[model samples]
Target chain A: MLKILVIGATSLIAQETIRHFAADGAEFFLVGLSADKLKMIQDDLLVRGAKQVSTYELDLTRLDKHQELVDTAMETLGVIDAVLVAHGTLTDQKAAEQNVDITLRELNINFLSAVSLLTILANIFEEQKRGVIAVISSVAGDRGRGSNYVYGTAMGAKSIFLQGLRNRLAKSNVTVLTVKPGFVDTPMTAHLKKNPLYSDPRRVGKAIYDAMKSERDILYVPFFWMFIMMIIRNIPERIFKKLSL
Target chain B: MKRYESWTRQPKVNHQTIVPLHWRDELPDLSQFDKLVLPFGLGRSYGDSCLNEHGILLDVTGLNQFIAFDEETGILRCEGGVSIEEILKMIVPRGWFVPVTAGTKYVSVGGAIANDVHGKNHHTAGTFGCHIPQFELWRSDRGRVICSPTENKELYEATIGGLGLTGVILWADIQLKRIPTPFIDMECIKFRTIDEFFDLSEDSHERYHYTVSWVDCLAQEPQLGRGLFTRGNFYDPPLGAKKEPRALPMIPMPIDLPSYAVNPLTVKLFNELYYNKQLRKKIGGVIHYNPFFYPLDAINDWYKVYGKAGFLQYQFVIPYKETREPIKEIFRRIAKSGQGSPLVVFKTFGDIKSPGMLSFPRPGVTLALDFAFRGEKTLKLLDELDRIVFENGGALYPAKDARMSGASFRASYPRWEEFADYMDPKFSSSFWRRVTSS
Candidate 1:
């Protein structure tokens, strides 16, 4: 019996991940931005066989509310076994490139806000000495391509921070896993044309759920993205930057 | 705001807009508008039954919610927008299954009821509407009302196969079938002709809970309707272990293929290989219901295989007495046309009365053929088949119908006026307009 907390519970991928847990009667605490969507998911999770489900509507970027959201989750779902951090938006590449304001906001939502919550959970898990903290990092973080360099930069920073967190928490038995998904078909990416490489959010969510069960530190969803990113990462800066990816 | 097509992707029309609605939220008041409004679910109805041409389509896929479930009795309740896939994923592990399901699990409950869809197991269980005990409907003329077999009976009968013209279905209470395991004990047998198929079905229907066959429409005369007949029954695993619901990986077809990709020659060749690929004449295996029921769902965007032009699926059921001669005639006409569908299905239907007034299934053997849109040539051929089906006193299923004429419609469903009496003035669809007009 796992007691889990899902932040950004209404996101397509996160909702799918919660379904796996709900099927097995896991207790849940969900936090998302939309009140209507949160209620819908709470009801859905209950029907899917979750033993208990509690939801809170909060804007993730509201720094002052972070502590309140976490405290409520911890109190509602006592002895949390795992925390799935699956909130983040694909930044508008053009908007970020032209405006610093847009770039800063994107960084706050994708990296800073998540780091704020993780910092709070890391300490809680550290004191408890048992818990898994899984965060979603994009494959765009592996190596920045010109097409989406700003989004890549924010994701890259988040991945680097999680790497340090995982290393530091190793001795305390608090496992931190970084998940890198590539081209998931979701409302976030609906504007872009889909290709053969695009994977369903449910499939990606399934992979992420499976990865957390094991003791893996870094997981590339769909698995092949690891090799694809490895090749992209190894490319020379001169040739890579010259051509559009 | 943009133009859209039916599931078939043919005759793209400019729609007012597609608003993917969440049923929990207050529905927008469309009474102010002059355009006819219709509820659109997963858009899986291969024909115009799901389309509101040049008008507003209230996209209802987002209303999916599981409202209630009684574990002991296997009775379930959910929003009409909930898909069969979502229900199976939740209940199958609990040893409960949908009483009836379509070829694809993506169809919404509203669509299933609207079409009165039937699956291979229809020989025993009947249409999807049969298991539905009650449903709530929202109409412009009549705000909201609950209908069922025993209560509000006329509306219930009309709304089931009313093709969404009656109103928007809010939620439904369904009685689910209990099963020992999620595994299906399946067997596939080869048959050379429609007569052999009839003989085989007569025997299989009593032993197995579900039965369906696939005919190679391209095969001529001596081998006219050669096919693989498949039958299955829910089986309990040997030990105490229950099978976990397995979600198959869906690899997408990235783009619309070239028209030549699925032309006559290729279909014939593929059918030849497919028939022979079943090396053993008869084979038995224990399998999950996912692959057993939904073979096409294994590939995401499989409809794209029909290419940009899209394809039409013509499924009509003729009574048992008229099965053989008409089936052979239809097969010969298809083979001679040099147009073929790689996947052509023939199945036995039991003597079950449809819960919907316009329901398609009756006591019969039915054949469904998919034909690529070849413009006039295709229309002419379907008209010929339509005439045959009409003459035999059989009806065309509105779910898979796009081009059924008013005369054929009248011949098939004499009770259309009975269904029309309860029709919501604010609701209408492209199919309804086409079938009942000049």
Candidate 2:
């Protein structure tokens, strides 16, 4: 049985991911910002085969309370087998570019706060010497594009940080995984036009769970994002800059 | 935008699709543009009830938002575009379920009320409108108004099963029922004949809250009407723990099947295997509410089985007081035509009164069948069945009727003239135009 800790438990992707675990009778300590919503999910998870579900309400951007949330979950689970950081927002690049205040706030919520939580969990996992740390990044992090560079820059920094964590935690046997889901159809992306490449949130949830179980260091959901991102990355800066991609 | 098709995939037509982003957002006034308009939800209607040919469609699905809900009392106020599936996803874990649901949960709340859909439990619960205490009706003429059984009583009765001609339902308030869990204790039995079915159904109805059957429409005179009857009740046990239902991954239809895939021989073979699948005379077990109620939902886009030509679902109810001769006659005609439908459902409707003036269910035995579209041949066979059904004082469900003679409809539903007075002059559908025109 997996003793998992899921942040942003109310998110559609996170909810679907929790469903996969609950069906297997896993114990979960769920953290979110809303008490009522969290409790509803707790009841839902209980029905989904979760051995036990404990919910804590704490806004992820409130870095001051990160320690308290982690301490309570650790006490409840004793030793967490997996720490899934599924919190982040799809930033509006145009807004971020125009407003420094918005840019910093996006960085605080999407990158810095995640880095803060990861640093804390990595220390606890370092002592345990065996735990998986997974976080949701995007294929956009593979390169800076004019369409979404402001948000892409933040995710890119975190992806690089995960690389460093994987290198540092390897000796301690604590695996750091970076999950780059291509284009999952969730509430977050419901507004965007979809095509054949769009993935269902449930399937994306299963893919992430499978990657963690297999202890993969880097996972590109649907497997096509890797090739697509690779091509985008290898493009010459001259042509890329000239194009409106 | 691509042209949309209903579940049957028949009457394929083009229309401008409009999705409102907010409740107060103005819906395009059809009178201003001189365009016929119909509100589209999930497009689960088996026919043209949700479609407007060569006009405009106000896709109100984007207006989906629950206005308010009292969880303890299970009274919910939500936007009409919200699907029954979405409501179930929210309330089921809280130990509550829809009071009445059709064979599928994909229908929108507005759609359910508009169709006045009935289910296996219609014997006790009546149709969907019986559970919908009130809703907000937004007509171009009346604007947004609160319509209920008590308030705007005429509109309330007309809008239920009014086929959306009454107006677009902006939001609905539904009354849900409490249950112990989402699991149902189900039992299945095999009956050899219609007489035997009546006896079995009478006995089962006394014991189970839900009962329906699948009959072999292809059977000949000697073996005719053999079927498997299924009854279920919400499984009750100690409530120390809640068990959530798990669904298998939905398998979307990869491609359209060949049009010739569903001939009489194939239907007969499938029915035989299905009828004999349970070797035991009686089998009972506990299963999820998903499979027990919405079996086809597990298979996404199961409609593709009908191929490119799509299909037509013929459903009718002849009063129990009428002789069984009409049913026997209708089946005889269908079998003789060599167009026996692969999916045939049979059920008994109890004395529960429907609130809708145009509601289809009555005290009767109902049979619903689906036939692949063979154009004029299929229409002729359906017309023959319609005559038999109407002559026996039965009516066809307007929600499922793609093509029924106006004379047959007028004969079946004598309240049509009274109901027609309330129809919104600015509202119409392909179905209304098809059935009401001379």
Per-candidate fnat, comma-separated = 0.46, 0.00
lDDT of 1 at B165: 88
i-RMS for every candidate = 5.1, 7.6
Place model 1 in a CAPRI quality band: acceptable
TM-scores of chain A in all candidate models: 0.98, 0.97
Give the TM-score (0 to 1) of chain B in model 1.
0.93
Report the C-alpha displacement of residue B276, candidate 1, in angstroms.
5.3
Pairs of residues clashing in candidate 1: none
TM-score of each: 0.78, 0.72
Judge candidate 1 at residue B325 and give its lDDT.
Answer: 79
Candidate 2 lDDT over A1-245, as tens digits, reads 99999988877677767777776789999998778767767765764567889999988999998988899999999889998898888888889989999999998888998998998899999999998898988888899999988778878999999999999999999989898988876657756766778876667788888888889899898798999999999999999998897
- Model 1, which residues run further than 4 Å from truth? A8-13, A32-39, A55-72, A85-119, A134-245, B1-4, B32-34, B138-144, B218-226, B236-285, B300-310, B322-324
Candidate 2's TM-score on the B chain: 0.92
Backbone collision tally, model 2: 1
